[model samples]
Target: MDRTTPRPGLRAQLLRTKPVDQIVSEAGHGTGGPASMRRSLGLWQLTALSIGASLGTGIFVVLGESVPLAGPAVVVSFVLAGFTALLSALSYAEMAGAVPVAGSSYSYVYATVGEFAGWLCGWCLLLEYGVSVAAVAVGWGQYVADVVHAVSGLTLPAWTVQPPGSGGVVNLPAALVVVGAVLLLVRGAQESAAVNAAMVVVKLVVLALFCAVAFTAFRAGNLTPFAPLGAAGATAAASRLFFSYIGFDAASTAGEEARDPRRDLPRAIVLSLVVITAIYCLVALAAVGARRWTWFDGVEVALVDILREVTGQTWVGVVFSAGALVSIASVVLTVLYGQTRILFSMARDGLAPALFGRLDRRGVPVLNTVVVGGAVAVLAALVPLGALADATSIGSLAAFALVNVSVVVLRRTRPDLPRTFRVPLFPLTPLLGAAMCVLLALNLGTGTWIAFGAWTLVGVAVHLGYGRHRSRLAVPAPVPAREPR
Candidate 1:
């Protein structure tokens, strides 16, 4: 009964009734209603979900920070980050196709690695999806406030616009947006998906417009000192650019809800990665080409600034700002959805409070939504954006690393397990995925690394304190059957 000690024959205990077949069958039982809610999402809707979740303040705001590091080579940084993301996506696709569950990488790790590793994955995901949602919400507030000021010829008080450490009293707008996203998620999954799809389209059209206009002013001179800062710069910029790719996991989280998940889950995860990477590269190319890389210093809204320069019209700025507002909202909604689902999985497994596992009549984890929403709202309203971004990036890289390893483990351990999709080149693909994630992690600052270590330590403590004792997998093992006489 000791919390840290697993039951005798722990693996057999956990594996008793939850083999992949049993899990899939249980998932199918309510496929009538839950699957219907999930089936409302299609390829386009899936693509939109990816676009909405992936395209946000990361590209809009982080681009300026990365430009300074890599100069015009920021485009290359984006490409490198995209490549890393693609590698991870392939791994996710293979695993998701094989195991199609709601916990995303957490579920895959549990089934392949062991219960303890699965618990860690669920914990790390808390930072990736939950904290990152707040970061996105905070970014949305900034753009929304900007648009309001431009259109109405008035600005909210400076204190309202800035977060606490940024010399402001409170970030009212950021907190409000987080609250709004939570309410939307608590209502129903179907409603959230529809709204997300619409917003995704709007955001993509806006980015396409920006690309078109910016190309008019594209200058060959901008390409002169690509990598002006050298390999270190490219690596550093890639680290920052990595943030833009964080939401690719959103596709995997929908595993429990996808129709024909064995097929569509992999398709959605890989397809989303391909589409988002292409869009990011195009946007980075246009933004860097349209103006001097140095000009981007101190600029927060680089895309809008590019549009303004190319079109020589103030209204284009207004239009771009509006698009940013909608895009950020979509990111918040999709990420919040992912966060709630992860907690629901953890709760169902008894690794957390059981309340999180309860689904309302609408098939939504309402309590989980409220808890996650409140935590993110407070964080968004209080923390510095830089700290939030770094924390999210580190957590995501860790999760990606585990997922890549899980794909390899599952392939070796359960070769007969049916997989609808497989990563090309076997071990090579997963190896590269882990390598890229490590390279990106190396780019994180010493402080960020320290913070990541601290977070992991905290997770260890929480597991021992609560999760170890309550884990459904830790129940006493059954006695082995005696041989027939």
Candidate 2:
């Protein structure tokens, strides 16, 4: 059987499957074809990848929006969201280690559940990462505006700061920040990771400064009645804050590049989750302790409210806003990185156009990075994503569920595979992880499911129209010849 040979029929083409060994081997080779995607990540860089992705948008942009829902108990919401993320992170860690591939869950599911499911997962991830990048870029635009106004008392033009629905032609700053990340990524993985690490440190230091500065004004009276809306409200807030946890699996996207995929990927995933969760909790506590929850409700930049409390100087506010800008920029970089690499893997496997998988001499997917950045920049400039955050969350949670189930299935089928990191409780961990992801997705409401359903329908159409027979894996591998008797 030859790889380029067409399958016999439509059904065969649509359902064509690749064995785990074949998929893993191709991924290990780094090219899967003529163009080779480079592997240049280590544990620290991988940690920066996840931290840079998930830590930006939530604390700076969404926390104020969530305060009305959970009151002072927003702190509890951060903890709960961390728990859900931990479950999914464990599953991703195990699979990334054992599979050691760039596609993340997309490659893992292809090996376990067949082609259609794999394509569906990859499609969902595309939605997740794309929206995440746009959403964070928009947030970055706002912070940048704040910093500029703080320094010079001159606001960025409204047309450049907001989308059309908000009475602006385009989010120019948002699109610009996305382009900045594009330039860094096009340089090379090592360059991108180095910048990401530096930004991660900046974000963390700013967050710590925020906590310390805010605690100086802490009165404790604000939390007297913490659960204003009750446990239900806290749970709802957790569902919303789960948006912040989207990028832990970003480390899994670097599985092929990780210096020790089996050891480093899992550690990076888990460590990033823990550090981000801790930061969220501390900041949430400090913010609530400093001001009543009602004060933060509908607030855009909640950290500024506390940063202004600096008795001696006003520079703290400027520093905090600048830190937020750096954080959001890093997030756009890391998530965009994940998006292109995953698509690269898909292209290599014949699911996407070969152009997307093409790598330049430096082993970077230059064209692919530019294309992804351009699409997301347009999305940030043209689309109002305020209402679509839930839609993005649903897509991410669905992909997480698929990954958790893939882990269990792969365990049964490929038990002999080398796994430096294994899910702790076997069936229990994955079962719970998959269930939690579905539970969170359901909490995203009916609108999200409708949007997801529509996107998935389009994906099915694309697969049938282009990816069906075009997939390189549709043809089976040839059998070895027996020795002459």
For candidate 2, lDDT tens digit of each residue in 1-485?
A: 22333346766555556786777677634343465556778889999899999998888988888888899999999998888899999999888888888899889888887788899999999999999899888888888888888899898888888899887889888999999999999999889999999999999999988988889988889997999999888887888888989998999998777777878998999999999999999999999998999998667888975788544466888888999999889999999999998998898888899888887876788888999999999998877656546766877888889899989888888889888888898899989988888776766667778888999999999998888667887645565655668
Query: Which segments of model 1 are wrong by more than 4 Å?
Result: 1-6, 9-18, 25-40, 477-485
Highest-scoring model, TM-score: 2
- Residues 76-98 of candidate 1 have per-residue lDDT tens digits of 89889899989999999898888
lDDT of 1: 0.80
Stretch of 10 with least lDDT, candidate 1:
28-37
RMSD of each: 3.6, 3.0
**Per-prediction TM-score, please?**
0.93, 0.94
| TM-score quality measure for candidate 2 | 0.94
> If candidate 1 were superposed on the true structure by all CA atoms, what would the RMSD be?
3.6
Superposition error at 381 for model 1 (Å): 1.0
